[model samples]
Target: MLTFEHDYTRLPEPLWLACEPSGVRAPKLIAFNEALARKLGASVVPDDETLAQWFSGNEIPSGAKPVALGYAGHQFGNFVPQLGDGRALLLGDVVDAEGKRFDVQLKGSGRTPFSRGGDGRSPLGPVLREYLVSEFMAAVGVPTTRALAAVASGERVARQMPEPGAVFTRVASSHVRVGTFQFAARHGEETTRALADYVIARHYPEAREQDDPYLALLECVTRRQAELVARWMSLGFIHGVMNTDNTSISGETIDYGPCAFMEQFDPRKVFSSIDEGGRYAFNNQPAVAQWNLARFAETLLPLMNVQGEEGVELAVEVIRGFEAHFDKTRQALRIAKLGLAEDAGDTADTLMDALETLMHQGRMDMTATFDALTHYAEGFDDIRREALLALTDQPEAFDAWLEQWRAAPLLNDATRFDAMRLANPVVIPRNHRVKEVIDSAMEDDFAPFHTLLSVVSAPFDESVEARRLAAPATDSQAVLRTFCGT
Candidate 1:
């Protein structure tokens, strides 16, 4: 049996609305994360039907108190003053063996008061996508929400076409988002302070020791987000929708809607069908994160000890520090990817810039290029060297850069190869592969989905099977745009 705590419910009433999950017709368990369940201290192994019943919201787990969280967001630069958990319910909190609290949520469980005229259901494709991609992100060492289970509703949801429905059970540190504070700020100063206090007590207890806890909390969140965005960039991951509500206070990547990994090296790449202006493009993530943090900062101004323009100046100072935090993390990542020592310094920066320029000009496959470099670093063989060169249209320029990289202050050959291997994944959940899995699952074929999941779970394995999934999509197989599945 799973036990849960109700700390969030203890918060002010405005933050969440008590509700029950709208049960589905027929629930069939499609996936269960046994390893994560064990980590969360769930010892009882229930049968598939029972697991489906609980996860699909047909039978709410004992000790669970479901609620729809309230928050407003700036969606694509437009402020939506009232948007909340339209199709999801927080199924209380769980404390792991290590005593860390995590929010257990059932997404696509059905509608709540915040449904706003839309059906509170999710199509199976998105449930599968989030399960695969979010788990892949966790495996790759990215801080992200985890999928504990997925259950098919055995029914259909209305989209452009009638699509099979599913519910996803997600675990995260907490669901508090920047937009939560925005909603709180609208209620009054005391409500915003209460929300901030709850967040600090739950996520940043260390801030309590600081001279100004609110200011310290803002800095902590800003720094975490900066580093998180930097990590995303290093992996060529684009989080297609970067709304304020999707930005977590705990700094984990949340809401895996319309998200994709970059196949080709393009700074301006945008895969979200709704992102016509390329607002949340691949390279624009860092800036968008800073902008979101600025919004978060606005909500905390009234609570800051310093009043008037002084508090604004202080907040602005912390917000501007995002650039430094991001650059430090990004530089360290680049150095590791290049297999260079920390002391290599400016040489690594110059070399990285030149290589990225070549990649952009050639439209090189980002993951493949890094994998090729990892192989070449193992030993300077003709075949491996040629493989790296093949990814570039300007082979001669790449060849020159390769010599510079080889001669730079790198670690010993063994250590350098090991570093590159760890930094560059052998496989990612490629856009085409994910799309294929979704299409196959829609036809009741799950073999491809399982195969892709297993391959991505061990992203650094250089096995023949992993290499088989490493290739980028061909022109015919490329997925140009992705939908939110709303």
Candidate 2:
């Protein structure tokens, strides 16, 4: 019965027309982020029925505005004239216990005026996929959007196959994206500055202290994005898509479709079925991030204080630092994965190159290869050594690399090695495993879904009961292609 206050109607001009939801009949609650719910000062409502009652367009939460946000995006290489929240509605921004502002968004809530003649509903698979991978990313130390909850829409929506529907409770620092600017600037330069001002007041207040807040905003986003792409590489994450709309200004991971973790250590891995040209491949993510940041820079050009060419040069310089920053952070992360904190200079790359070569030649287990290294050095037990031996046909080659690794002055004592394993996860949600879970869920079996969640929740520890999670699937279960649920 708590009605949320909304002041959007008093905006400088109409942002979006008030619209009702379509394509939703019986919305059901699937899951809730208790951590984020407490952060947002929201309490649980009980069962899926209760959640569905609220989301079925039959009930509206008071004090929350069901407003659609406006933003444009580049689909591939082409720009769309306009794109906004088609199936999503903002339930308003909530301040956390620490006073940080975060937006509460509902995906598949229903349709808005932006629906554009399509069914504005999220199928169950993508909802579950986002919940799985987003939570996994957070556990693995990556900055990303968090899934608060998922609810089934007691209704079914038609996609490749007719499927039960669901809604996801997504939490983010702010919904502002690079595409957000593209929308505003296209409206007018005044609208552009206004949006930038709102962003500064809301997220980056320190930018207001600068001489040129708008340009400072651009620089801040670029720096954060550069470092974020670096972190992704360090963890072997492949975003699969780098569209401008998919880029969040808050630097938290957003839009969880078609994303996956690398399995074979291939920098050129392209898991998203839509990425035919490998534009956003595993190795290309860093460059793609720089490219997106460059677009952000171009959007902020009107506020740039420097002359034309010089401003462009400064933007180029900032973008140039992306690769260097990515390399530096990834190298440091690579060292920690190998159980060493200090860099071994060129030796680190040398050993990494050797590992990649061995893994590629032997078709090694990507996640386990780095993790097993620590166990081999620490336990020295046959089980640990055997784990390493199983990775490839080239134990002699790996042994040679391990000698160089073990001889490199140990950065930490044996106890520190134990701590490093905890830092670097041994298990990740592999594509094949994700596919298996999805396949089961498609058949209305939640057992596999829950099983995957349990194993993925603690990716570092290897329980004998959960040993299956550590092992790659047999050759037949190998998943070579992943698709966008669209």
Top candidate (TM-score): 1
Candidate lDDT scores, in order, read: 0.92, 0.74
122-237 per-residue lDDT for model 2 (tens digits): 88888888888888888877888888777777777888778888877787787888888888778887877777788888778899998878777876787778778877876678
Error of 2 at 432 (Å): 2.0
TM-score of each model, paired residue for residue: 0.99, 0.92
Q: Among these predicted structures, which one has the highest lDDT?
A: 1
lDDT of 1 by residue, 405-445 (tens): 99999888769888998889999999999999999989988
Shift in Å, residue 268, candidate 1? 0.4
